[model samples]
Target: MADEKPDFEVPVGLFEDFEDLKAQVARLTAQLQTLTEGAGEEADEASADDVTAGAEEADRGDAPEDEWQYPPFILLLDPPQYDDELRALTEWVEGVLVPGYLAEPSSDARWCHLWFEHPVAVARLHALWLAWQELTDPASCGYTGPSVWHRDHLDPSMRELRGSSGPFAGCTKGEHQIDHRIPGLVPSAWRQNDA
Candidate 1:
């Protein structure tokens, strides 16, 4: 028995796919490291000529107008950009926020499965995500970053989002309220005059 070798079979395509995924991960990791290292250095080291040249290129439309800027607000983004951002937000919400903090659901602490459908909820969650990113970054927010995030950003946002009277008021732990509606505001006299 000791002399006999155990027989196991692995699929050829699975090995190739695994190798491809590893290579992609390596490339992405290198790119992320480069960007992280350059972020502050590039800003500080840029000469006036570099700035002027960049501005000139932008004016000439050589730079793409839709080039992403950091810390983008979800509501202000174009449809394509918004869709990309929403995907990322959904990932964070489902992966981190829900699993870590909001797993339990109750009458007092409600959560909507279709949270992204609610504009106000989306905006608030986006803001909370932005704050979480900044506050949890050690270089940006220091040693107390996580603590600050929980105390200042997380707690309030969660309370508001999960409150009984909040945006998820119509939703419940077990069900999503498809027909949930925001109350209509009274029309302004000036706007009514235009009609």
Candidate 2:
């Protein structure tokens, strides 16, 4: 095994070039750190009005880098960087999401088109979709795939979306009928109760 040839080949002079680039990066990083530290000290001397003005920029959409509107998993909005992201999400929703949720009519979960517009629903859906994609991917061999899908993604999202104390609490109140009901959707029995 010791005499076996390695799979990769490295150019003779590439090592020195890598070392040179590494040193340059370290030097530039140190310079940037010093500049930022100095700028922070100057910022502390600003008047109260100036600090308040800076905060207004955040509300005005001028400072969104640190205050992005959507989570990182949301690839469809904020200018729609990934073109295929929406397509993939749509396909999954149509193919898996609808059927899975509707399979159990008694499950508290039902299809609501307006959920696409709700902020909380959109965020959790995007997270769950991303995790489902990763776990089903052929190249994803990590042990964390299923764990993340169930623990970090699905459980919390479902709890937030359909738990008794969740957003749908009032929507699902006393509406058990061996069938799912959309949030805020009134069935005939609901009207009868008011009589």
Candidate 3:
């Protein structure tokens, strides 16, 4: 009533002795491990029990025939930064591994496609593709978009070049500053220069 907190009796520390505390903890830990091991063993036993049923089902021809589906396009592009590399990797898979997998029809071969999730692996393949492309064409400069090599990202460069500077810069306002292209690369702003 007077705006003061009420007092209550405090409880004593639960474990009075270190050895007892350690023994209790050890017991709890052992109990937990035993429970977990039991659960795991039961699960394993259940799985083992399922084997006969699985074999019977397989015998009945309920198992699917071997057929490979093309990997999902979006999953292939999971690492957008490695798009160039992924393209080459997928090409190699389609060319070399896929044919072998199809010919062999083995479960292990199916996993080769799954192993391609690593971006670095895809990038390595992409590097190979670039090397091949350069060797074959001798002048294929690839998508040299502003994003790939410009000062700011691509959208800004496109916006600036299109005569709309920033959100505030108006057509009649600031004197248009002709933004340079990526360093060391010449940009053809004028139509005739593009040729």
- Indicate which candidate wins on lDDT: 1
**Model 1 stretches with alpha carbons more than 4 Å out:** 1-54, 57-70, 178-195
- Model 3: per-residue Cα lDDT over 1-195, one tens digit each: 899889976444332244345655775787798779767765455775688887897798575444223333333344663465466567766785356423432222212233344333343334443443433331222232222323333223323322223221222222322232325756544223323
User: Over the full model, what C-alpha lDDT does candidate 3 score relative to the true structure?
Assistant: 0.42
What would the TM-scores of all predictions be? 0.60, 0.39, 0.21
lDDT of each: 0.80, 0.59, 0.42
Ranking according to lDDT, highest score first:
1, 2, 3
- The alpha-carbon deviation from the true structure for residue 182 of candidate 2, after best TM-score superposition, in angstroms, is 20
Clashes of 2: 0
Clashing residue pairs, backbone N/CA/C < 3 A, model 3: none
lDDT of 2 by residue, 1-195 (tens): 999987998985586456556656775787798779868787668899978887898678585463335335563354454335555666777688777653442346643444554445666777789678766542332434565577777777776776554444444333423223456855653124434
**Order of all candidates by TM-score, from best down to worst?**
1, 2, 3
Better of 1 and 3 by TM-score: 1
